[model samples]
Target: MKILCISDQIDPLIYSNTIKDRFSDMDLVLSAGDLPLDYLEFIVTTLNKPLLFVFGNHNLKELPFYRHSFEDRFRFYSPQEERDALTSGAIHVGSKIHREGNLIVMGLGGSLRYNNGPNQFTNRQMNFEILKLVPRLLFNKLVYGRFLDILLTHAPPLGIHDKEDPCHRGFKAFLWFMRLFKPRFLIHGHIHLYDLQDVRTTKYHETQVINAYSHYIIDTGAAS
Candidate 1:
């Protein structure tokens, strides 16, 4: 299956087909937050594709309606499954081993800290959550032996993907998780630079880290 990833910007096509016109080739969409609700609605309506996303620090009041809209296609991860977690979030898709097929994926939506919202978790508080969830809830799947196909988190992993700005905080625990799990891919959003550059890729610890924004596509089925 093909996966199209995006984040840190508003979906430009809801008003019409402006953004969608450029990215008609994507089979599935994964958003990393900082987008408009109408843009999401457009994905369900005009684009008519499956989407998964996490919120950025700036996005507000979008969670309730988002879950209500794409009840089946949207997935967000929790502190229970990962130390890095987000509020106003839900887990909508596959797991580590699960991505082997359509590719199992899990996501933590929202930013490093909540400027405002309901389900936000602090960095330290998030670590406490990971301490509670790991060894118990994590690594219990088919991908446990080697590596998970994909591990999605709203927070970027530490210095690996971080930029040099105050608002550009990266998730340390996420980096730790990347080193430990060694998933085939690490997907995330939040950094504005990455959102603007339109593409960022790194080969770290045997995994491919990608920042998906406005328009991105990959045919994973044929890659392996």
Candidate 2:
């Protein structure tokens, strides 16, 4: 399958009216985070494909819709009223596991705790979030012979594609997760690439770690 991965910035190639023709063959769309909800909704609606995304540290105006309880949500707007309010047809896969066809994807969104900002977590806090998914991962291992096909996040893994700065630093918990679960791919976005010489893809253990800064195309069959 051909999967189009996007994050951070909005690419003109994707935001144009010719998007349907330019990426007509894309089977799925995955957003690593830090993107506008309307952009995702546009892609899903135009392509008529499944779009799965997670939250980043920015462009999160509609985050409360996913974080609040059903009762709390009703206070703002009724379920029917809010249905088309934000990212209308897209799915937020943060801290959750979703299966699309034969692919199993797990999302762990957010950046390392740099401040008291939304979508930021400490190393311990991120680990606890991972712990919440252990049962489902183990179940996938038993049933599918693999823990997961993809680990989607907003930040890269520590010491891999991460920088030394606190805000851009990757999570150590992600390294531990990759070592144990061994997903086929770990796709993240947060670090922006300016120079063409900067690396965007890296091989760590059995997983292919990719930084979806502006956009990228993953042809699963080519790698397989």
Provide the TM-score for each candidate, comma-separated.
0.68, 0.93
Candidate 2 lDDT over 1-224, as tens digits, reads 89999999999999999999899899889999999888898899899999999999998767777766345645666665466555368888999999988889999998999987877899999999999999999999999999999999999999988899899999999998998999999999999999999999999999999999999999777321
Name model 1 segments beyond 4 Å from true: 11-22, 64-101, 114-120, 128-140, 143-147, 194-199, 222-224
Q: What TM-score quantifies how close candidate 2 is to the native fold?
A: 0.93
The sequence of per-residue lDDT tens digits that candidate 1 reaches over residues 1-224 is 67777776663443455656865666666766676544665665656666666555555454543333344246564535333222223334311122433455555555556353443556775566456545533554443454446666556767767766645667677767677766677777766553355447777787788876554566666442
Give Cα distance to truth, residue 57, candidate 2, Å. Answer: 0.4
Q: Which stretch of 10 consecutive residues in model 2 shows the poorest summed lDDT? A: 68-77
Clashing pairs in 2: none
Q: What ranges in model 2 sit over 4 Å off?
A: 69-81, 84-87, 222-224
Tell me, by lDDT, which candidate is best.
Answer: 2
